[model samples]
Target chain A: MEPILFTLFGAIAVGGALLVVTRKNPMSAALSLIMSLFAVAALFVLRQAHFLAAIQVIVYAGAVVVLFIFVIMLINVPENRLPIEKPTVYRLLGVVAAGLLMIEGGLASRNFSAPATAVGEVGSVEAVGHALFTDYLFAFEVTSVLLLAAVVGATVLAKKKI
Target chain B: MMGPSAYLILSGILFAIGAIGVVARKNALIILMSVELMLNGVNVAFVAVGSYMGDPTGGIFAFMVMTVAAAEAAVGLSILIAIYRLKETIDITELSVLKW
Candidate 1:
């Protein structure tokens, strides 16, 4: 049952992500991205990472996608250009790179074995908070600094008169 | 009885498709969406590995990735809006201002 659920959510997430890239309409693409994010959060739940799952939905599906849609609407991309074309060389290079990446990933997967422990404890928010403050305190502080930098940089870049 | 390998492979395939889309598409918005797809693919792999390894760290990393992705989307969209205001077009070909 667990495997089945995993497979189902995994398929949904991958399929939605593919749709997000393939869809021509920007709005449709954004919607597909939202679906993909939701599916990924579901996978996190299956993995017993409940805290991660909640953050995935709230941060990604709720906030990021909404911002994407807002920008899409604000820009109001004119439909004057039906389809944009890329160089054949670019397409070929993309294919080659993707193929190589998949091959490398597949080879790497063969060497990995499941860990001895079974992850039965749910990754609750409290647990994650405790872990972040205790074992991962330095990393957590660094991430906060990084986030602050991002906020400041974004503000500076978006400022009209600055 | 699908194993972790199956999930990993699926994630890899999805990531590949996203890479293709990013390179093949000429619309900047679409390309950004493709990048998001790639990020999602990575998140899927992270969760799968976390579960299989019996470690919650992977999931925590996945959340961090999501946070980064959100910031990326915000910054990217703001840049797109700035470009659209100046050039009035989102076509990648038209963005040859920096090309020397």
Candidate 2:
């Protein structure tokens, strides 16, 4: 049952990713990205990182995906105006290169072995939060600053005549 | 439970697809979305490793990655919007001002 859930969600995740890349419409691609993100969140749940999974859904699906769709709507590109994506030789080469990279990554993944350690479920919200505030406190504080900068920068950049 | 290698392979596939989308796609928005996908692939690996290691540090790192991803998306889309307003097009191939 456990492996089944993983396989199902993992396949969906990969399939959604493929849809995201293949879909020409930005809205379709963005929506597919939400599906992909949701699948990843589900995978997180399978990993016993329940809190992170919820955060993933809230941040990624609830906020970021909506932002992408909103912009897509705001710009309102017509179907005809969408970029003409032809299958050029160079693009095919790029695909080949990416494929080679994927093969390499898969091969490398096989050699990974976790060091001998306690096999316990440690992804609860409390556990992860403790680590964030205690060990990763500096990084946590910096993320807030980063987010503030991003918000301000987005506002300025997206504004007209600024 | 599935081995970490399975999850890692899945991440590899996701990352590969994202890299392909970034390189092969012409639309700027799609490229940004692909970047998100790549980040997600890494996040999966993080959580998977963290779970196996019996520690929460990997998950902590993933949380940070998520934060960065959101920031990146906000700024990247803003840049995209700015580019569109100036050039009135989001096709990446034609907007080659940074080619120098």
Candidate 3:
């Protein structure tokens, strides 16, 4: 059962990611990215990180991809002028590098084993909230400050003038 | 239960694909998207390991990573917008003003 679920969501995510990279149209790529994000969210559910999964769907697929789509439309680059490059030697090199990395990862994972402890319904929002406030309190506050800075920076950067 | 190895392998493949996309894509927006993909791959690993270890720390870390990723996407797209305004093209290859 677990293996079947993994196969299903894994296929969606990997396939969607491939489409995102290979698609010519930015909008289409954005759509495929959303698909991948959703699949990742599903995988999160399988892992029992229910809260994180919800956040992934809401923040990533809902907000982030929509944001990308808006920017894509705002830029409005003509389809004919889109920066679609033909495959080159550099791209081939990229493929080789990726293949090497994948091979290394697969080899490394062969000996990987889960710890003896069971995860068992421990990733609820309440548990995460407790940890976020207690153990990770400082980091949590820093994240808020970082987000505030990002908001300001984005506005200033996107504005016509300072 | 699916072993951690399966999840780790999937994350690795996703990350590799994302790295390739970053290297091969000339469009700045696509590169940004690829970076997001790489981040997601890392998030998957974090959560998977956390699950395997029976530790909530991994999930919290993944959550933090997601927060950072969102901010990054915002700032990156804004920078892309500024770049487009300046050069009228989002092609990283074409925007070689800083090269010389």
Which residue pairs show backbone clashes in model 2?
Answer: none
RMSD of each: 2.0, 1.3, 1.2
Q: Which of candidates 1 and 2 is the stronger one according to lDDT?
A: 2
| Residue A142 C-alpha lDDT in model 2 | 95
**What is the alpha-carbon lDDT for the whole of candidate 3?**
0.90
Residue pairs in collision within model 3? none
- Candidate 1 per-residue lDDT, tens place, A1-162, comes to 878887788788878877876677888989988888788788778767788888888888788889888888887876665355636788788889899989998998887777666555637777677767887778878777777877877777677644
- Residue A83 lDDT in model 1? 53
Q: Which structure is stronger by DockQ: 1 or 3? A: 3
Worst 10 residues of 3 chain A by lDDT: A114-123
Please give the lDDT score at residue A50 for candidate 2. Answer: 93
Interface RMSD of each: 2.0, 1.3, 1.1
- Which ten residues in a row are the worst by lDDT in model 2 chain A? A114-123
**Model 3 misplaced stretches (Cα beyond 4 Å):** none
Cα shift from native, residue A143, model 1 (Å) = 2.1
